[model samples]
Every structure is written in C-alpha cells, then in structure tokens.
Target: MLAVHQLYGRQSHAIDSGRAADWAATFTSDGEFRSPSYPEPSTGTAELTAFAERFHAACVESGEALHHVISTVDVAATGPDALTSTAYLQIVGTPRGESSRLLRITTIVDELVRTPGGWRIRRRVVLRDG
Candidate 1:
C-alpha cells in the first residue's frame, strides 16, 4: 500500500509536469481510467497514451499549470496481490506565476493489483459530488 501511494504521488507529478507518457505508464498494460472529463474509459496503453497526450496538449494550450492533489488515501488489502484504495482528488489550475484555482474536487476509487514490477492500477473510477 505504501508503494501504491508513492506511485500515485509520482504519477500526479508526471501529469502536472506534462509528462503524459510517463504518467500513462504508471498503470498496468491493461489498465482503465475513467474520469468526468471524458465520457468513456481509457483502456490499455495505446488508448491511455492518446488520452494523456491530448490532455497535456489541452493543458499547454490553456497555458495553465494543472496539478492533481491527492489526499486521504485509504487502502484496503483485498487479497495477497490485490487492494482497493480511495482518495480525495483536487485538481487545481494555476496560470504561469499566478494563484491557483480549484478546477475540480472528486474522489478516486482505485482497484489495484500487484505485479512483478510493482503495484499497478487496474481500474480507476473518479466520482464527484452531485
């Protein structure tokens, strides 16, 4: 679980820095990401890569520094090699040299599996308040 949290931290940094490819690599080969920004889930590396690239391009075009602040990470060990985690997601946008604005606040539920390399997210579901 500690390693999973660390991975999340690194993935968030990668996303914030526009390292889209790197961010996408944090998931398993057959991973799935579901967020409010997109209607469908991004599954597998190719799809995830395209989604990440497009997201980074949009962020760059917007000229804002997007940051995902994850907190309150609660982990549950489901089995020997599987776990579930839920965390608070705060997506902030800060224009160059300006104050940050809260773009979205949601909760992320992640189903994770342990792999030979490390822990990887199998599916991530993002939910926001109604």
Candidate 2:
C-alpha cells in the first residue's frame, strides 16, 4: 500500500518536472490513461510517452512550472496482485515571477498491478466533478 502511494507520488513529480519518460515508465507496458476530456484514451508506452511529453512541452513553452499535488488518497486491495486508489489531484501552476495558483482539481482513480519492479498503473481515469 505504501509502495503504491509512492509510485503515485513519483509519477506526479515526474510529470511536473518534465521527466516524461519517467512519467510514462510508471505505467505498465499496456497501461492507459482515460478522461472525458479526451476522445480517445492514451494507450501503450508510445502514446503514453506522447501524452506526458506534450504536457511537459506545453508547460515549458508557456514558461510556467506545473505541479500535480495528490491528496486524500484512498487505497484498497482488489486482488492479490491488484489494488485500486482514488485520489484528489490538484493541478497548480507557477508562472515566471508569479505565485503559484490552482489551475484545476480532479479526482483520479487508478487500477494498479504489482509487477516485478513495483506497483504500476494499469489504468487511470481522471474524473472531474462539476
């Protein structure tokens, strides 16, 4: 359970710090990211890498620092090798010479699997509550 949370923490930092490869590596080989905002889910390492890389590129282009702060993490075991988690994701941004501000808040529900290396996300769905 602690390792699962750590994986989430590392993934958040990886994305915020523009380490897209590392971010994508947090997922399983065939993992996917799903959201209502996207017409299609980002599946597999290639697409996942693209997704993360694009996000980092956007932040760099805008000269702003991005952060994903995960809180209220609730984890539960679904099976011997599977676990599920629901977390509150706070997306914050800090522009040049400006204070950090909240950009958005979404609920993240992740299905994770225990792999040889560690717990990796099998699927993650981002749900926005209106």
> Global lDDT of each model?
0.89, 0.92
Q: Which structure among the candidates has the greatest TM-score?
A: 2
Best-fitting candidate, scored by lDDT: 2
**On residues 1-130, what C-alpha lDDT tens digit does candidate 1 reach at each position?**
7897898999999877878788888889999999987889999988988888888888889888788999999999999999999999899999888898998999999999999988988999999896
The TM-score values for the models, in the order shown, are 0.95, 0.95
Q: What is the C-alpha RMSD of each candidate to the true structure, in Å?
A: 1.1, 1.0
Candidate 2 TM-score over all chains jointly: 0.95
What TM-score does candidate 1 get on C-alpha atoms? 0.95
Q: Which residue pairs clash in candidate 1?
A: none
- Give stretches of model 2 more than 4 Å off: none
The residue-level lDDT of candidate 1 at 95 comes to: 88
Report the Cα lDDT for residue 122, model 2. 96
